[model samples]
Target chain A: MSSTEKHIVLAENLTVGYTPKVVSEKIDFQLNQGDLCAIVGVNGVGKSTLLRTLAGLQPKLSGSIQINDSNLESYASSKLAKELSVVLTEQPASKNLTVQELIALGRQPYTNWIGTLNEEDKKQVQESLTSFLLEDLQYSRCHELSDGQLQRVLIARAMAQNTPLILLDEPTTHLDLYHKVQILKLLQELAHRKQKTIMFTTHEIDLAIQLCDKILILDGAENPFGAPCELIEQKHFERLFPAEMVLFDAKTGSFKVNK
Target chain B: MGNLKPYRFSFILIFLVLGLAWLLNISLGSVAIPFKATFSILFGGQVDIESWNYIIWNYRIPKAFTAVLVGGGLSLSGLLMQTLFRNPLAGPFVLGISSGASLGAALLLMGASLITGFASFSFLNDFSLALAASIGSFLVLLVVMIVANRVKDTMALLIIGLMFGSITAAIVSVLAYFSSAENLQRFIFWSFGSVGNLSTQQVILLSIIVCVGVLLSIISIKRLNAFLLGENYAQSLGVSLKKSRLIIIIATGLLAGGITAFAGPIAFIGLAVPHLTRQIFDTMEHRILIPSVFLYGAILMLLCDTIAQLPNSANVLPINAITSLVGAPVVIWLLVRKRKMLF
Candidate 1:
């Protein structure tokens, strides 16, 4: 790659797990600006652990993670907040917050001491509201929103953070197929249009293959990192599951039930 | 992100109501001072009766100020607790601060007589009572802070607080069983709760402690707002969880522990005032909430004190009874009518 295409996240020989037990190790990946990436693996394969480590929510077992040309450990929390943001799988503690207020929380790092939103902060919040199609529901309490709408609101909150990189743990988990695709496509548009590097963990491998610019498949060993077609061409998806249960159809880029 | 202009009118109205309630509270004591006389006395003007002037300055004014501080401090701590734990049911005393105070006062009132045979300490003043309660609450607060540091989960901390409450209550019960009748009576009266009988120095001390607590809460406005997203998200937003939690707990200790120390464990106001303020404000922002809850709490305390005085009657009801009698219904009615608690 050229120097102009900056690497937003660079992880080398990364190991992630709780202390005294290793969940996933030897993971290496680099995401450039404007890349929409996905981490796809079977359940209990430490996909969320990997994302959590990358987001600095937990300590990595070993290896170096760099964000925006600085070591992840080097940046102060407030400074790091401007470089990356995250969308969690768990619901917010208080759903009594309005959609607008929740999204405005994204500007916390830039807000004044008492969290008064300046003109720029308000502008970013408005832009995020517009992007996520949440304008009509800005005043609506989060508890009143549907699952899909709440998911959109969450992603909007991360977008309003205006970081160079975004990491989400299982952004498509509870949604139906259409809504999953809608969220992934929205994330794709956000990445490309805003030149933000986005990464998320999901079991929606088939959808991720169709929507993402890059895919990191964690298969417990020799985790592969490449384009979707390259991953499919190498038959990585074929070995993802037991052949007796399901099979990968590389022709149409999907999984088939072995009936 | 919108302007606060919309809530400005409500804030002004609430301030006026607080003033009215303060006037009403001062005027309706056993002496039956007129509202006009009370108002004139407040603004440094003279009342016709010399004794009435003495009553207004020396007694009712201090009592009303104590009520304001007790109510405002406890309610602010309650708001802090609710937000910090992310639980609607959390109150200032939820962490066993008042229970500790009770245990402290119980030991001083009953246990002392049980050991010394009631003659040596027959004349127990408010000073000794306040001092004992403050020590007890401070000890409990210290233990809670130590436990809070070790425990990672907020819910677990809440459970630990309740455990502390239970432990202290059992000790108080044991002490109450062994005491003499006179000592037991004093203890019971202390538990009934009061905002009166404080000297000028004590009120000033309570005011200083409450001011420190309020200042801490004000400083924590940003972190509290970020916390509405929960801990993980709040951390990602650059809030230091340990630091914020410590500041909030210390603020709660000062407000709940200190007020319970001075006011003899006044109940219900700390738990209900935040919810009541939320009924009208309709927002979760702490910048609006801290001041709003304080005003509402002060107003409620004044009104409750007025009713407890019984207006021209010498026999005063327990302020604790009046608070529950007046407050529980209003909260229930508001929740029933609104169909949801804002928290």
Candidate 2:
């Protein structure tokens, strides 16, 4: 790590899971400012669980998360909100809300009693809309937007929040290939240009490898987290998929299923 | 700039409709007073008889005001519940608050006389009944909030609320079975929901509670909108999930419980008014939706009250029954057409 680098998120000995059992344990991870990272895993390998733990959406088992050198638990929810923004995969059922209104919700942390958007908030919201190319649909209802469009709208909402750290869970799950690339590109741009530490969980390992600055691979059987290159050099990727159908091609840096 | 004029004009038009509805409600009644005479009576002008003044001032004004207050209160609570639960079908009735209130009222009406005979203490009077209903509804709200806090899934919370409502309804049914004949009549009448049953003092009390609740809800607009995304997202926006939930539950209890105490368990306004407001304004900003629903609900309740008072030879129809006649079909149509729109 560079001496000048500021660690925005640090997970020490973290254990994440739902009721009855733990998904993973003893996890230590650190995300520096402006780092674009991806958490990669197969289905049910606890990618989302890890993200939720980092985002403080779930209680950690015998561990601590520190954001910006402060204990995660110590930050009041609103203060934490001012520092971090989260975008989940589930769509909100606020059908009557227009795109602009939905985006305006990002300013909730800063709004007064009446929820009025001030000039600065308005500028940020407008910039988010422009960056997401959603200006055309700003007046459209969320229910009327396409799945890809809705996903962009949600991202715009998070961008409008203007937090230093952003966590997304399967943001491109509903997007087409073109939009998926577009979104990943946008996230990469956000991390570099806006100096945001972007962490997202995705099953698209190939795309993640090409775009992410660092990849945290969670192998269900063995070590849950390792740098993408470390895992690849260790030949851990081969065992992630079944041996018969798919093989990890180190040359191409991708998995190819035998047809 | 000129195109935006229509939006302003439509807003004013809706306001005018609400004003006209209020005026018509104040004027037209069984006594059939002229508009000018009613205005004069309201503004302290000459009236033919003291009885006319007394009827207009004491009876009609309070009754009309009760309708508006109860209407606005129920609809506001409905809007809040729908937004809080993220379910369009979720309202005071669906979440069991109305049932809880009804059970409390039934207990007061049915169990009071027996308790008074045995213990020489009367706890089933109207004021006591209103208090009991408020407590009962608030208790249900507390339970719902606890469940919502524990469960992250919105659909699961909705299911739990429905189950709670059914449980409260079962309790009310059991109370109905053991009640005396006269008490049963009173309980049954209260269950049908009427806006005209409030005495002047009762109207004043209900209005105060409803207005306070509405004001609290108004102040919670930002938090409520944040909640539109779901609890986690709302929390991420710095909203205190527990605090917001408590405020909503308390406000909902006050509005629904107060209305139920006096107007019985008024239905359909809470379920139908928010949807209508959403359709009219084409936006979900609570700043607009809250006030719009209030006006729309008031007009709807007044219109239903008018229909209930139609020239039925023997008696007026129950207000609940009349509202259902109008509201049920609209709800059914919304369900059919926008099957997936609602949560």
Candidate 3:
């Protein structure tokens, strides 16, 4: 709780699941303020599920999730929403909402019952638009934006919420290489400069290892949470994918297929 | 400056249209009263007491009020359903609530005499049918909510809703088969949909129900806006998905069920008005969308009612028939245009 010891999220023996089915069990972890974390795993390895559980989007199976010392379950949804924001992969189906209007949705928890945006909310929305370099497309409809632009718009919305902890599910899923690096770099910069904790799931293990301060690697059998260098020294990357299909090139610190 | 100016203009335009529609509704029924006389009678000025009483109290006032209530209620329900499911096709009819009400009304009409003879209950003969229809709509709403909760995909939920509607329609068809000729005629007339069926007392009751529903919707606007992103997103935003969905289902049931109980399955106002409101407003912000839809719905229903009551026509057209005539083409256009744009 000290100024330097900014604890953003804490999970103790956390188990995440849908009803009657446990995805992962007995997980204990802590995410501090200014931590850029990546969750990497094979397909169907519960990376998304774990992130959702931390964000309070999905119910926890057992144990507790604490955000900033208060139990996650005890925090009122609106109060929790103010402290934590989430960006999902699903594109909203609504057609007419503009980029600014879409990003303004982040202020919904703060807005009154009538859903009107106040001046402060509008200022935050503007800051988000500017920070994400989306000024030109501010008035453009969401349907008209490219997938990459839409992803940025969604990120901008989460940013606008000004939450200490931001959870994203595959932020770079549909982006090109340039935008992918740009997004990861932006997230890293956010952690460093804005002092926000960002946890995102990604398939780009190399980029995450290179940019993230901490990594939670889920190998389906054993999940490890620690610094990237520690995980790398432990040779965790070598076992991440199938042995025959792909191999981790330790010298380049990237994944290369043997075929 | 100009962009904000147009929104103000659109607001003015909507109000103007609503006012004009109100005037048209009060002045142009089967018993044509002069607009001036209607206004004078409404404003407490003394006139021909009998005609004034008949026009102001009996015919025009109740009909106008019914049009407003039914139009506003159905459209608001449609807006909420569309937002809740995140499907453009979601509406009261899609969820099968209307057909459930129809089936309930059909059962009452077909079995009223038999029940009256056996039970000797006077109020049962009068209010039992509406009560049954409301309960039926409420049950269908519950089922639809359960199905929606089970499904993750919005499009899949829409299909499930459609299937529910078809199931209710099938039940209604079975009930129709067993009904006597006289009851069949009465049920068929009810199914055709009409605002004129509401008496003053019924209009007052319907207004109370619709007001409650609209008030609930207004209170939940912030939650509804959160839901636009999807249920998970809404939950992460601190909305209790289960509670929000329950409130929405109840609101939808009350509005749809109450309207269907008296007006008999009025269609298209809910679906079409929201689309039109969103287009005119050029924003998905529900603060504007909700009120815009209310006004647009009232006007649209008023226009439909006027068209149904053609001056030279021997028989009034059914309200549902008129609304579908107006509504179907718009939906078809939405589908066709969406396809072309996507392709």
**How well does chain B match by TM-score in each candidate?**
0.90, 0.90, 0.89
Please write out the lDDT profile of model 2 over residues B143-176, one tens digit for every residue.
8777876787767876876787777678767866
- The alpha-carbon root-mean-square deviation between model 1 and the true structure, to one decimal in Å, is 2.3
Best by TM-score: 1
Q: DockQ numbers for every candidate?
A: 0.75, 0.54, 0.54
Q: Pick the candidate with the highest DockQ.
A: 1
Docking class of 2: medium
True contacts reproduced, candidate 1: 0.72
For model 3, residues A1-259, the per-residue Cα lDDT tens digits are 2567878888887778898898887677788999999999988878899998888877889998889999988888889989999998777656556888788888887877766777889899999998888999999988888888888898998998899999999999978899999899988988889999999999999999899989988776668889888888889999888879999987778989889
Computed on alpha carbons, the lDDT of every model, listed in order, comes to: 0.89, 0.81, 0.81
| Candidate that beats the other on lDDT, 1 or 2, i.e. the better one | 1
Model 2: residue B189 alpha-carbon error in angstroms = 2.5
**Sorted by TM-score, highest first, which candidate order results?**
1, 3, 2
Candidate 2: misplaced stretches above 4 Å? A220-231, B1-11, B114-122, B147-178, B311-314, B339-343
lDDT of 2 at B309: 61
Candidate 3 accuracy as TM-score: 0.93
